[model samples]
Target: MKLPNPARRSISPFGQRGLKSFASIPGPTSLPIVGTLHKYMPIIGEYKFDRLHHNGLKKYKKYGPVIREEIVPGVNLVWLFDPNDIEVMFRCEGKYPQRRSHLALEKFRLDRPNVYNTGGLLPTNGPEWFKIRKIFQKGLSGPLAVKRFLKGTDEIILEWLERVEIIRGKQNLDYLPELSRLFLELTGHATLDLLLKSFSRDELNRHSTSSKLIKSALDTNSCILKLDNGPQLWKKFDTPLYRKLKKSQKYMENVAIDLLSLKMSLFSERSNNTQTLLEQYLSCPDLDFKDIIGMVCDFLLAGIDTATYTTGFLIYHLGKSPSIQMSLYEEAKRLLPNKDSPVTEEVLSEAFYSKAVLKELFRLRPISVGIGRVLNEDAVFSDYEVPKDTVVVSQNQVSCRLDKYVPCPNEFKPERWLKSHPLYQKNHPYLLLPFGHGPRSCIAKHLAEQNILVLLLKLIRNYKIEWNGPVLDSKSLLINMPDGPILATFHAR
Candidate 1:
């Protein structure tokens, strides 16, 4: 039973490939069109984020540090890693834009641009990005975020803790939706003050069409994510999925316009007690309505998604290892924080084991597999011609997982990050960048840290988490999730 060569045909997302070098690129050799696709099938559903850190390591080892393959017909992507390449990637802020490449990132620009646009920080590039980045540095980065965000985390997290307890006594539940709801609510209040403190205890919640437009922008683009590298059916034809994806874009565009219109009724009246985020933007007379709202939307998407998934991973790993879990709980209890003594600037700074737990979780499961950067110019890397618009994809996931950095990357070891370990600070400062690095890093880095810290402290301090079903690993979907409903048991401490 010999298989005939199918490389003579054209390859699209829905097409076939005729290139010989395709099989040699270190991907799964057996189902070529499918390639490594089946291995990822375990990831199709809700618990996706749980396994991303594991899959990243597996694929990188099976392939090479750098993998080149078609995500779709006529589209090729290179996923590369090597610390030296960091400078090649981030040194310039011009020719290389974040949203370029197969992201079909062009599709995201229906609205006017700001920080998250393909040029400023999240995904954007150019002279405009450099200037805008400066404002972020002065306004959002470093000391200010740490100073302002650390205090509010306790109140926000305590509210989420009660919501999470619904699954604590139950068995075989889909806790991710719970986590998402919690994260979304937490992000809204803590970051934007856009929603109620606790989930409205209501189902079929109302969302403005403009809000839908904001979500649609994410969903439509998200629909194209892993599809670029799979089979070739939808690419060559007007598949229903493609139609739906296109329709979503149109719906979102109309939604964006509706939300962008300046209305006296739409604006929230300023009060002295309004959250800092809303206050800052409302006072920025230079920021137009459409762009500011879009930026707020972008901020929510990035901030909420990362924190939810990362906090989910932290809990998952903690549940996986009992000894470390015990250690964390004991340390948190030793500190004994109360509402009267909430997680404050000093409390967060003083909590040594909390830092270890977070750093270890981040080391093992960086929410982003690698930090993405746009090459500002056409550059030579190891004498390779990386064109002006090329996107640099580093293997931060595998980098931190490697034996050199974390010893046993697969095995969870909070002990590796202990203060006594001499290699703790000096060995590689950016190895565990769950919040990202450099100037373009997350504006809510401190905010996320505080949020996760509060939630984890509460959970560990109250109960010990154990599994009631097959242990799940983190998977990916834009960010990350567990492979399925995480079934766990909680014993009160």
Candidate 2:
């Protein structure tokens, strides 16, 4: 279906006639004091806070494409399931797209005025966000900068694969934990040029710094979800969850500062030939130590679980479908004929099928619940006049799964994304943004994709993956992750 032009419907003058009032938008019934908060209450309510993606689909079915809810007394949220409205949301996002998430983390940073300049990239908005983003973008904004890390990243993948073989020992293994370690190592190498040795036999002990960092990140993420979704009494005072979040943040901060100091001390000795992402930041004249430290922490926190879960899902899908796996393997063999062949820029470009498979996985199982934005101006979505500053979320997850937008919504068909294939789908550009869009999009997009692609190439070329456990599903924990252990058998070819 061709969507109506979003440019024509949005950003009308305040006195414009015939535009429906924002209050008239359809939604679940709101109560006096609680607002729509009661709708998520146990037994009495239909929605579960953790199952927000499921709730989004249900909301679209019950209340059409545009749904409204006062999540809390003062927090009004408008969810746009229509791609056209989603387009409008982006177009009107203005210069600094203010995505109001990680409020608890933002407050945590703001409380520590001496340690942090702002809440980092994820939560900081407006001019402050723009300032930090510009400097970081210089280092990792495009594919060219990301391609430099491919060789180092490939080496890490090879080492992790060796560790995987040792750990699996001819049995179905829960690969998520190992994948997490692999990504942490990759992130460390790319960000700081630091070899975390996450997969090293000697470093496998629980007391290692890598292990502590991983644990702290996971604990911090869990606390974020709890505090963000719960009643948020922490905002007023230091709740136990808030305190726990601070403790985790403190540990991560200390690690980043120590690493930064070491890197600065060794900066002059390092060659000017191939610079690490951290080196690029240090070379920047504008960014201070505080800025670089914050970026490092943000990259580490954001990188690990996201790539781990995404690659986990990709592997799970390949294991479940033999035909798809075989097809991908043929492409992988063409690009990587030998097990030790380096995944260069040319190889990455030629691995079209592998790219499609990742795209399809993202469509079926996006990491985030949805892309959100606090509108910069008043806009009309689905004929309702949504006022400025309203939190309008683009429900890409729900939209991608609908039969109206996607032909085989439930099926894992990568061909739909290929232009040369007969099953090629002409989808709206805004429909499937796994890394989001525009200026506020993921800063580490290329690096993350490179990591996943290199891993996929090496793994598929070496083994035949098979799912050895129950049907897998996802549960949201800030980001969507496999609800149970990913039990898979990797049969060496």
**Top-lDDT structure, candidate number:** 2
lDDT per residue, candidate 2, 1-493, as tens digits? 6756655766676656777788889998878777777888899989887777889989988999999887766778899998888888898899989977888999988887788888999899999999999888876889888888888999988988888777766565688888889999999998888887888767778888888888878877777776865677898999998998888888889999998888888888976677667887888888878777788889888998899899888888888999998998899889887987889999999999999998999999898877889999988887788888988888888899999899989899999889999999688888899999999999999889889999999999988998888877777778888877888988887
Candidate 2 lDDT score relative to the true structure: 0.86
**Cα displacement (Å) at residue 25, model 2:** 0.9
lDDT of each: 0.56, 0.86
- Per-residue CA lDDT of model 1 for 1-493, tens digit only, reads 1221223211122112332233244543334455445544664632132344555566677766555544333444556554444444555444324544223223344333542244224445555656545544444565455466555556666666665665466657655555666666665554344443334444324363423433554465355555433454654565665565556555644533443343223455544564465446545664445445445455555665577667767767877889988888777776665423466666566678888888778876677666666555654333234555545566777787677655556787767677697535443544556665666666667767777876777778877888665666555555554555656676776
Off by over 4 Å in 2: 6-8, 14-17, 170-172, 271-274
Compute the lDDT for candidate 1: 0.56
Q: Cα deviation of 329 in candidate 1 (Å)?
A: 1.8
After aligning candidate 1 to the native by TM-score, how far in Å is the CA of 428 from where it should be? 3.4
Q: How many residue pairs clash in model 1?
A: 36
Q: What would the C-alpha RMSD of candidate 2 be, to one decimal place?
A: 1.6
